[model samples]
Target: MNAASQSLSHSSLAYRPDVDGLRAVAIISVVLYHAFPFLLPGGFVGVDVFFVISGFLISSIIFKELEVGRFSFADFYRRRIRRIFPALILVLCVCYAIGWFTLMATDFKMLGKHLAGGMGFAQNIVLYREAGYFDTASELKPLLHLWSLGVEEQFYILFPVIAWGVWRWRGALLPVVLGLGVISFVAGVQKLPSNASAAFYVPQYRFWEILAGSLVAYWSVFHPVAVTRLRQCTALREALALLGFVLMGIALFVIHEARSFPGYWALLPVAGASLLIAAGAESRLNRVLLASRLMVWVGLISYPLYLWHWVVITYIRIIGADALTIVSGTVAIVLSVLLAFLTYRFVELPFRRARSSLPKTAILVSLGAMVAAVGMLSFIKSGLPFRPGLADKVKARETYAQYFENSLPEWAYFSRAGIFDAYRMECDFFDLESYRAGHKSEEPRARIDAGCYVPDTATKVMIWGDSHAQQFYYGLRQVLPDSVSILQVASSGCAANFPGRAQDGKAYCDRSNQFALEVIDKEQPAVLVIAQAYGHDSINSFVELARTARRAGVKRVIVVGPVPHYEPFLYQIVIRKHWNDTPRRIKDNLIQTFSELDERLERKYSDGAGGFEYLSAMRHFCNGEGCLIYLGDDRRTGLVTYDYGHLTPPASLDFAEQALGPRVMANLELQ
Candidate 1:
């Protein structure tokens, strides 16, 4: 037999270039999934490929040493530190340096927190809680790929103890590993559907893939002769390897991001990797493909490649002008490969080649501690928002701080957009709808301690509709002169001109609209303003509501068009294009229908042909550059619409100055 086949056919845990080829497959799969998800949606299963490799290799080492009665935890860890820390520390420091320049304030703050998690090998824990709706997009997180490393490291730390403690008998360890693997696999399958994030991130749910490898390692060490004889059968070896490849192919094509992952789906990659490993180099498939020179080279540097690939792609996306496309992603991948080669050569090789000594381990540990300290300090200082050179980059984030709370464990957008309570205060009713659920005893909630309507003894403008209308109170109060006092009476739902058929507690909406009419009649406001989130065909209803106001003895009626809106939120735009970039295509993400609606309304009604003033909120806020994401040149004016389409205090004030004030100026005689 050839030397290559001789080395691989034994289960002695000798060097195997074919295994490195497997590493190449794993790393490439993960990179492809991250860089171009559409191309290989299930490529993420490559991480399971890695788990099996780690389990077999590490278990082989531990079992060999324990058999000889010479195993030491110190020796095991010193080796682990040398293997894992060099590339890790290098990647982290580079990320820190580059992140300082490119990342916005909130993004940087999150980067800091992730750095802390990665350093502690608790990235899986960090990631599990980070799957909420309001958090930054997962693609923008540079250290996100580290969760797999964190999982591997945790297993390496814990599994060796289990192996050594259970090594009393010649065959004792197999059942323990097998039983644990069964429990982990079953429990993970049960948990995946309901708590997908936890199943994906948690080690307990993941350890089964590794233990499958341990089972292979156990069989190999105990039955090396039998394994060698099995590999010597060319037809059987070819069949086993072919089946492994087929399973992996099915996994890559069939599984996807939408799948409840790492459940039954995990068996494919695990079984595939195990069969390929057991098939040995003698198989034509293993010898010709996996042991090829190119595959071996990529496998040699796969660890660093995995580390570099995602960060490169993510950083480019964080700052790139347009959305990430295949071309840009290809560029990112090429750069990652180059960086990986450099890291593998300069950073990883030197440390790995050195003798495993206490001082060597100590130096690596110290470097890690220093890097962790930098991460911790950055996190404690809130990503150093005060960093000297970053002010220009950070100003946009600070201007919209309420919309970008990066420090919290979960994100809820617009939670601090500004006084939401004021809109519901004493008028807006949400609890009234829940009476259908038999909460009749639950007192309907409306923050009515504060008067629903703004009090004005003389001429005043009253705004009425729903929370969309009421939110205008802050901005109008701030911008309009004190003489032009305003009234805001609204409900949580749409307000009608008159009552509709009421059921359950839905009567509250009609009552709220009636209350607005009552306030309008009692106060006898000179100008009655109607505002709400307008639907496509609601203009007729609005005109009817306008006629209702006129009948209530209103001197003049102003209809406020819908405010500009954004989807998800506005910060996504900030991550891609800073508001200052000329030709930034801020128009891309804006809901175009609102701007069109505003233009159409202004053209149809500015001539007073509709019998009242129609103030286009979109006209004052939107232009050729698209609806304003934030107001003012430096954007210290804050977000125009704090949430999806409700104006902030500053925006409302701006609206009053730009739209309402001009319409009212001639009549009110305000300079």
Candidate 2:
């Protein structure tokens, strides 16, 4: 036992402006990363920075109180309420109020669920399961950033009690906390390969980062003499602080969304934060750079700044891509900073300073309860579906359904295969899961049409890929003659890959893709058409998959180019932005984001690689004016796509007849 160290209690500690300065660094990184990921691809690590900071500060307070024999769970939680609730309640209410008008039933429902997650400090768990394909839901959910808070609060719920128990047995707290942190780190590494999203979000996989700071707090508090001696060395202090910055700099520049994060990559930010904190106020760089007036001011508001920026940018994106200009983004950031300052000054300060006849804790708890009530109401009421101006929108949706039912005959491939019901929501956002629990409930029982194989008078045309491929079944039926048999096979989350490992529960994708290849060899279908979600996987991977199909003795392999994708869904876009009584044409700014990629694919593979063809599905759906937004004669009749990128039945038929049919039939007259 370090008996001498126990004498130095919480009374020895003083506020460090450099800590706030470090906070400024973390919050700025996160805000910029969310708004402009490219500029700071690894900026998400800022949250880890916050995690370490929270652990150190929270642990120090608990240890200090425990040493003084004044530690109370009630007091600890009340302090937390004062620290966290004011800004959180305000943000939740604002998002709820705005969403009442802007969000549809489903989106509003998601918002409610997310809001509940936020209020309960379980946002991480909620978001972990709520992920969509490519993890693209981040930009959509306003309170997604609250996931960090969830991890922090969850830690506090467990940590203080554990610390109190361990503190009674002298010197046991450090070993116990350190042992738990090591276990968490090992678990995170194990989970990363099998499921990166799980590693990123789950509390068990994430606690090590917080514990790293907790360890630092323990070291600083209990070994005050040793720490002071170490930091007193001017050269050593500067070098350690600079090394911390270097590690964080590497994380900010080198790591990106493509990287499996919160794995080994997370260590950089955690270590960096630990080093900066351990370096303490005496380090010259920490004093000069981190503790500067501006840095401290920003750090003071970092909490609210973090809360405001995402909601601001997310609402901007929800409005439509046109409004999400660089100028708009800059404005959003500026506005967030302004709001953050006001919140810090008025909302947060009052709560922190106020003493009430009723305890401040009670007021904060009540506010949180009210916010939870709002979220619950939104969820239970299905986003208040009776909001005005939705009659025509509902009618248009109904009309689209009727159009699909009436256009049924050309769906022979799906009818004979009977694969429609199972793979119906592939490439869809609402139905997507990170590692969908229901998918692994059973192995995929794919129903392939016998005509897809068994060579006869019919020349078989097989469509292979994900849901995007299944969508073609509708179009091919309309354009191609009766003699030309179309075979469609697809799986959600498979997205046309060289068969390999997928997220947990998605092992079926590899088997299905391999089955597709085996079918190619066995059936020797005249055409192997690969259609997948747009702007996913690499061009090399797609080209390699096509090459592999050609080697399988498929006479021709047509690699379909990226489709025109829409953000926030085409229907929502129309309902929110273009839902006027008059007919309106929709241009796809989202597709144009991928226009360069589509163009590059066509240019590289257009000339044909061993009877291989590259068909631009995008071109058929777009023109000089813009991408197709409506499938029928007018916008009122039917929109082009139901969700973000999945084609409506009419658009599928239109795209097939106009683009794919002519391309496929050009070289072969098998009939």
Candidate 3:
């Protein structure tokens, strides 16, 4: 081989111990973050470190082959398959098996969806559509970590194609790659504010991290002498390497999920990883610290280690237990390590090294088909509800039919179903399409037409607040006499008290409340009823709303207090109760935890209200015996709450008629 070819061969064939050590750092950080997040808040940045390392290593090999006129796309992909597929497929299959026994139908169905995404290398897209990165729901998803793998695989597929194309036009490669990186980084920063989940997971935003590594590869190839000279500068090399380590430390310690990420904040770790890679093994930090035998050992099994850790942690969480105790967490970590080693030794090594009768392409295609088939089957069967008697358990529950009877259609429950039938006749249901398209402020109000629900001469009762107010409408419609008509001016999550104040940086609530206020001013209804789910500022908002109503010429104002809530979904608790025979006292404790807030809000608002009247829903649903989750002795006939807090349609009607109807009527002098 020529000198350049010899150098390339040495670099590609000879493993850099320090690189493995870096892998150790990345994997450890990620595993720790998953197992004990409080210990290392920014451990998620480890994924970024791996991305950079992948970019550097893969690009170096591809660039070296291109320089020698021996680059083969088939060979590149073959190596990728051997390296990535074995451990991944094994872990996925194991996860499917565990999930079958442990997860609920809804959770299993979601797992099936993720399985399909994992097989297709589209897990990131699937997760992005489902929930945000910081969502509590994400912690329960075993396959969520595969999103990083998906991103890396996407990079592998695209980068080689781009690099090969650029190689043909050698002079343009640098400029094109650098320009794309800059554009991608800029786009990620801009998108973080508006669509953080998309910005975090989408390939376009993440491509820059991989490209940063590719740049180092290009530099190493074209300017070998400069790289050599830089390595010779021991002081500079040590400073750079140490500085990179510090940056990584900052990412692993200071950053958190709450921070806007993969934006400027991402640079800290990405740049650190790039600098460490560029510094070479001769540097003091790399030689003494990163290149240690222990670090290299961990690095060797990092891929499989990462694959096993999350599923173990997620399974523990899925069991509905508290966070893992230190001993339990340690055991989980040990188990993951042991499994990773076994998988690496028996599964990963054999597939990678052994020659078979089938061609590599055929083997890959067959494996892909098997994965797809399994995922499709799981999805089609709705996660095979027959497993562990889930179907039987659900069927045996008395409230099974009752649950569906009062359940709103999916769109309506989600607050996307638009206005009620009463308002639909007056104006198009708040123009949902227009509102979604940024024309929210221009969307017309949902008004109740005169003589729609009552006679033209009847008194008008207008209800306003957030979704809690919307929930009251169902009950009010059932109990209100023919002499009164109801007009609902409510939007999901829109607090009536502070229409203009933004929540979570979204202005949809503000605009919706503004429109509701305008409707109240124009209509001048006889009674304005305000209700909201209790939140931090809810009490203050309730007082302010009452004042605003009196000023707007609404004679009577009624403030409805919040209902009971539970930590987990009430349905999940009910399901658990079926299997565990949970004590009534235990159930009461869970109910009390959520009810305390409701009780406090009621006491403060009802006792000291000035002009308007305050009514408590707790009186009907909760008492000394603990809040009613289900009604009727059969335990299946009536469900008081649809979710943890929201009332079912029947329950809403019952509460309004039995608890609220008399009080509201008396206040309006209609009794």
lDDT of 2 by residue, 1-671 (tens): 00011111235367888888988899889888877777899999998998888888888888777878899999778667777888888988998887776665666766887898899998988877655453334666878888888888889899988998888796788889999999999999987865666788889999999899899999887889999999999889999999999999999999998777888999999999999999999898799999999998988888888888989898888766344667887888999999999998899878666777877778778889878887878776655555565565655543332232211113322343343542444422222332444222213444444544444445778888777777777778778887777665566656666556443434566666667777777777788888777444462266676677767766777778777777766665665566654234566446566677788777777688534788887777777777777765656345666556767667777877888888789745643
Candidate 1: tens digits of C-alpha lDDT, residues 249-366? 8888899976668899889989999999989877777788989999989888788888889888888866663445788988988999999899878877776566665588888889
2 against 3, candidate with superior TM-score: 2
Please list the residue runs of candidate 1 whose C-alpha ends up more than 4 Å from where it truly belongs after superposition: 1-12, 355-358, 391-403, 409-415, 419-569, 572-578, 581-585, 589-671
Candidate 3 Cα errors over 4 Å, as ranges: 1-14, 132-136, 321-323, 387-469, 479-514, 524-535, 538-568, 577-628, 634-637, 640-646, 650-671
Give all candidates' CA lDDT scores: 0.72, 0.73, 0.70
Cα TM-score per model: 0.69, 0.87, 0.80
Ten contiguous residues with the weakest lDDT in model 3: 1-10
Candidate 3's TM-score reads 0.80
lDDT of 3 by residue, 1-671 (tens): 00011111234544678888888898899888888889999999998988888777788888888899988999887767766777777888899888876666556766887888887788887766554211225655788888887887888788888889988799888898899889989999987765576688888899899889889888887788999899899888888899899999999998998788979999999999989989998898998988999988888788888889998987875565335668878888999999989997898768766888778666766787698678878776665655564555554442342232221112222342223442222322234444333233322344434432332444778877666777777677778887777776665555575554634333455556676677677676777877776563432466676778778877788777777765445555566543446323234325463366656766676654556676777767777766676655534435565555766666777888887777667667842
After superposition, candidate 2 runs with Cα above 4 Å error = 1-12, 134-136, 320-323, 387-458, 481-485, 501-506, 534-540, 581-585, 634-637, 666-671
Residue 136, candidate 3: alpha-carbon lDDT: 29
